[model samples]
Target chain A: MTAPHEPIPGTTIFDGRMAMKGYPLNKMCYSFNEAAARQEFLADEDAYCAKFGLTDEQKTAIKERNALALLAAGGNIYYLAKFIGMLGLNVQDIGAQQTGMTVEEFKAKLKAAGN
Target chain B: MAKIVGGVTTSHIPAIGNAIANELFEDPYWKPFFDGYPKAREWLAEVKPDVAIVVYNDHGLNFFLDKMPTFSIGAAPEYQNKDEGWGLKPLPPYPGDPELSWHIIESLVNDEFDICSCQEMAVDHGFTVPMALLWPDQTQRPVRTIPVAVNTVQHPLPTPARCLKLGEAIGRAVASYPKDLKVVVLGTGGLSHQLDGERAGFINKDFDLMCLEKIVDEPEALAKYSIHDLVRLAGAQGAELILWLIMRGALGRKVSKVHSNYHIPISNTGAGLLVLESAA
Candidate 1:
């Protein structure tokens, strides 16, 4: 068996432990792949999340539109991206939100990395 | 017998799809990323490979956690792209080569890499973006495809070394095929960029450039990085670089770099493009 993964300070691994914990949240986000499901979630947010049996933490994180909170609540970025997309927000906006940067600052950090 | 004409690597960022749909190729914000592709397209036009094996990861579009396959290959007659939320319009279905797909499936399993064989798969941007970048005009798409899906979405993702072996296995599969064919392997996704947690928007240029250089000559050097090492150094989603190794492995021991491009901050990611021709 492989050794336990050493934690990365600001990153979540989304391994089996996290996957099992976040299944309900991710399962709900996965439904957004369909137009009807996205529309349904938009129409009744709380009911939609409730139907998926999202944990209170997941539900709260969703309400806050917080990416880091979602991660703490067991959300995988790829799946959570679908949920973020439904909010008419792309990765940049959520990225800025997570790192506490303005969208421009977040984008600038990315640009400077290339320089 | 088949010949691997070359390999192409590019980021399959969904934002690129939006930029394409909006005809923002010349838009300053997107110009650098878009500029990288024309040379790649020129290279493709010249090679005219009959088949393209796309090595990419699914992003909640095909398999959810319910039944995630560590590795999956499309054996369907055609693969389709579906609504991935955020309303990126799905592209037309990509036709496939079932015969070739089966040949690869058998060879990989024989090589002891038991992968999931999908009769049906819904490819997301991971598959479609690279196709669009390479063959912008779908009607004129000169190449058929075999999507080799690796699991980068969840943890316990395959190691860089293992994925390289898988690619070598695929190379053997293509070489053994009886038909005369030309194949191009495409490794899609990542130079480096993290997309989740307090670390979102992370980009590592040094690591990105190192992989680009090493991928050409020292792929085993790349294989040396453990999955955790990659996540730590490359960022979470940046770990998708392993997919590129699969493309590199198929290129064999010697290759000549045809053209390469790298740009950063494309929707919170470092986008890279590389075209290599087998020299061995």
Candidate 2:
């Protein structure tokens, strides 16, 4: 069922529609829950995404390692967290990339906003 | 017959767990957030429930996207905390109440809520952080826990209405138990703040305060909120606040607000803490 509301700007809600659209990408990230799966993906990214049946858009997003792109391609942040973890990145790092700021800048913004 | 003692709702932010583990509460930056829990600790000391039903969402820890359950009940005797790849030191295993968990599972299913029964599950920060906040002394866990894991990670998360209904069913189930047990429902997660996308630092204090106020007495009104509305109004990660409804549901209709604390930007979250005692 579609949400009986207008879409919020600059935010891609990971609703059922996005979940279905990005299933392959999310499933691939889900595989990272296992250490061996993470290692396998690191060894051959294309082969791994192919196994999970990622779409061309998802494959590109994975190759790019862009959190926003993955979200656009149907990657839930929690699942995508595993994918980012594989790259030695944390949620703050992804947040920085999404907001087009450096990690230090993003953290500073967080501190300032809280104050 | 058993009675519902109360419900506790808090944002199970992972950073809060780290601060507590590292003893960084004394630090000025973290002091305010940590300060919010002493009253809760005192309250728990006063009315120690025999069983606490912890309602939280797993964040890619135990059940990944492979077979995500909409509602999973942990019936195991013990739940171990695991490292979620960020190297946060895992906490000591928490004891579980199998009997109560089974009762909840059977009752929820019979109540038409298809819940996945989990005999084995390792809890992430979503489960452990709140535990630490409630009972800081690891040696003395005040209550046996039955973890209720909900699907807020993947899409098609149970609507607010369904979550409220699930809680009500749990309340009925708890009341049906033959033992003279006291139960507390703990709902953890969200009060607005997104962790990703261009709106990463988003925090709506007004929206969150509104939620905190309404959740105490008018939770039924919250069921009208669609997930889309939740994400748009409260941040994406903040949408997990729906889990709070489950705890509120288990408390029955009338509840007394015992104590509450809300702070902004606890690492990209409007962290909230609330305690509601069953009016009965």
Candidate 3:
């Protein structure tokens, strides 16, 4: 409670932690839970593509990118592929276990297990 | 010759910009919501303010999640669009009026309002959404702007009363400036919205209307309400409305509501807009 316009003395504005407290939803949790995000993930290829206006190349690129990220972290080939598929990516299953996974925990486990 | 043109309060939901610019409003989900604000569209064209001091809260875009400034003012000649991990939205860079900005900084300081001035910083959707809403045509950008960022995202967030006092200081700063330009201060964010777990989609129309009432007719009354009260009733995100009180305070004692629109087209969030002309 500093004086009006005193700027709290040494206040610095770049702290993201404080900024997120203002509207944490934009960054809350590791993944998006909004219906729109879920709907897009569940939509059929053509419908999804039409909605986001993404080209086939762009979609393919997203899949490759996610797959590369998974591989780099040594994720289970099968679950990683499933996760990609869930996002409507082009990757197919590589015979990995379908063990229930929380996306954040899964990433952490993948990293810990590999490293 | 800086004249107080009035004040504007609006919700700055990031999705609104994409919905409007990409014409996604036609999507059944978003279209009906914006259609509710025909008067806002008309007012934007009618008032056509010459300059706007936009008050908004940055969501860790320009400032990282690590360090937060309670308030920062942009005094740069131009502000570039930022890339918030999702890639940059290809909008033209905003042209700033540095001379007027410096004048504001000096006047505010003289009036005992310590302001942090920035020459180069990327502004996020919090700044752009309202800009796009009121100036969709990008016509004159008629309002050369003084961008004011508030730290609404963090705890120990500034109290509603504190924000109002700051607004009064801002009004003094603008009123005392020696230039000659019509200035409108735009306060961005909230009517009543909660975008968090379990409480996501909370909308309190009653609280929203009360806010509209108090902001225009009795801003001092609103100062009694706390961030806790807003969070408990309207949800945490709704607390951002504290920024509006600052605009109201800047305008001072009595303000005539020129136009106001409140709509809830999105989950747990009420999108509202209002324009106020100073009593003088």
Q: Which candidate is the best by DockQ?
A: 1
* Candidates 1 and 2 compared by lDDT, better number: 1
Q: What is the lDDT of residue A51 in candidate 2?
A: 99
Global lDDT scores for all candidate models: 0.90, 0.85, 0.63
Cα TM-score per model: 0.98, 0.91, 0.70
Candidate 1 global CA lDDT score: 0.90
lDDT of 1 by residue, B139-254 (tens): 66577889989998888889899999998888899999999999999999998988888888888899999888999988999999999999899998888999999999998889
lDDT of 3 at B280: 65
Specify the CAPRI tier of model 1.
Answer: high
Model 2 backbone overlap count? 0
Better of 1 and 2 by TM-score: 1
- Name the best candidate (by lDDT): 1
Which lDDT tens digits does candidate 2 get at residues B1-280? 7889998998887778868878998788788888988998788788878888999999988986668899999999999887565555656788999988898789889889999999999998899999988888887776888999999887777888898898899999999999998888899999888887788988888888899999998998888897878888887777787899999988999999999988876877888999889997
TM-score ranking from best candidate downward: 1, 2, 3
Give the alpha carbon lDDT tens digit for every residue of B1-280 in model 3: 5667688888887568657867775687666566655666566566666678889887655663345677788999887665433333557778888887887777777777667788987777778888888777654455677788887765667889889988988787777767777788889988776543223344677788888887888888888886667677666577888889888888877788888876664433577789788876
Q: Model 2 clash pairs?
A: none
Which pairs in model 1 have colliding backbones?
A: none
DockQ of each: 0.86, 0.52, 0.04
| Candidates 2 and 3 compared by TM-score, better number | 2
> Per-candidate TM-score, first chain only?
0.94, 0.93, 0.26
When just chain B is superposed on the true chain B, each candidate scores a TM-score of: 0.98, 0.98, 0.92
